[model samples]
Target: MRRSRKGQPVTEIFKQLLCFFLHGTSRHLVFFDTLAKDAGYAAVIESESTSMLSSHSVKRFFRSFRWPRIYLFRHLLQRMFLWRLKLEAPDVVILGIDTMVMDNDEAKVRHGVRPTYKRVKGF
Candidate 1:
């Protein structure tokens, strides 16, 4: 599913995103600025140029994808997941997700803030 469009390939962008989540300090785009400066981390992406993509470039790349393309990517990911499961062939497949409560009580003006079960103000 490689596109002929110029610039970074889809796999490279996906690798950058994976690296971002694995090494990022915070769950924000600002972390990309720090990641871009790390030579050791840049090598992990295995790209021709040992340079990390900027947050702006990543944002632009995400914005460029339409709903249909995004759905197609999701389907591709699902297929990959199924293929990996087949290869692993585990006896018991237990799926779990961890959820965290973000506290935003310090904010002066809360737009979409709500009170969680913990009685904290956050999404």
Candidate 2:
């Protein structure tokens, strides 16, 4: 566990690992602030005046960076979910399903679609 200037506990390793998505001081997204807020470190980050990065700058570092990889972000998210699942269910094999139906009627060339669901027996 790492702490912010005001002594709030944060997963510093995770934050450093995520820095791979940022290119430079001017090019990045405002994700860290949101992360800090979500992870309960917003107050710590906000109070760090002597830090190299202000709270807003730290959050938006990705927007100004060059050629940040989006795939890395996606992969990190997937792995984080899997890791959390393992931590919560160390000895159990959990299976789950998402039954989400998106409104894709506007798509001109949808890849996969059942013209009609046999189970629903409708259009």
Q: What is the lDDT of candidate 1?
A: 0.78
Count of backbone clashes, every candidate in sequence: 0, 15
Candidate 1: minimum summed lDDT over ten consecutive residues — where? 43-52
RMSD (Cα, Å) of model 2: 10.1
Model 1 pairs in collision: none
Candidates' TM-scores? 0.63, 0.30
Q: Pick out the ten consecutive residues of candidate 2 with the lowest summed lDDT.
A: 44-53
Q: What is the model-wide C-alpha lDDT for candidate 2?
A: 0.48
Q: Which tens-of-lDDT digit does each residue in 39-107 have in candidate 2?
A: 334343343323323355544443534344667667788999899987898777768976655556666
Q: Which parts of model 2 have CA positions greater than 4 angstroms off? A: 1-47, 52-60, 64-68, 90-123
Best by TM-score: 1
